[model samples]
Target: MSMANLSFLNVLKLDNNQFTGQIPLDLRRLDRIKEFSVTNNRLTGQVPALKKGSVSVDSYAGNLGLCGYPLPLCEGSTKKARTGVIIGAALGSAAIVALVVGGGMMFVMRKVVRKKKEDPDENKWARSIKGTKKIKEG
Candidate 1:
């Protein structure tokens, strides 16, 4: 990423990777970053003060060697992290439900497709739809 041409990055989705060291200082310069994340990695050091609602605690986990505000000043980082986990879990559960419902809907549509393929009457009607004769009134 050339520092010369990254002025409009609204979302920095760097989750679930192996990036080490502290959060890059240069990132603070990007005011357009609304969804910054560096979760499930080995990143250490203080958590940066992200623009409110722009970043969440979920974006700073799986690393057993990091602390600071948002992660919970120092004394309560562990407790706060637990809460974040519960929240993440709830969100995760909702996502799973959505996927299941979507999958079921797709499955039902596939069955409908198969039934249509099995029914010759439906096929013939659909095939002749554009060729049907228009009746004239006397």
Candidate 2:
């Protein structure tokens, strides 16, 4: 039953009920309502404004579709924005990793070329043998 027509209601506790849709707008006209709650329901849209500091915010918990003061502002594109940020970060990390790896490979290739130029006549095995012979003779 809609509680908006109840004129003399002082305290209303409709928690844990399967009430769907929005709280009736006419409820704001109730002057004597001191405490009200509709928690754990499928209610959606802006909650009907009540007297300031009259009811605790906890009384409105578990209604996922509700949005207003004390609850976060409703946002439909939040998931999409979050996904875009994650994809951008992943692409950025991949680019940085690729550049670092390519630079390292270039450095290693340059060192190999320098080593080859310094010893054109001797292969790697021959250089090691020659160095060992020199050490033994000394």
Best by TM-score: 2
TM-scores for the candidates? 0.46, 0.47
RMSD of 2: 13.4
Model 1 stretches astray by more than 4 angstroms: 1-5, 74-138
Report the C-alpha lDDT of model 1 over 1-138, residue by residue, as the tens digit: 853146677777778888888876566667666777787889887776754345767777787667776676665667889999999999999999999999999999999998878774676566657777889999
Which 10 successive residues of model 2 have the least lDDT summed?
Answer: 129-138
Decoy 1 TM-score against native: 0.46
Best by lDDT: 2
CA RMSD of each candidate after superposition: 17.9, 13.4
On a 0 to 100 scale, what is the lDDT of residue 128 in model 2? 62
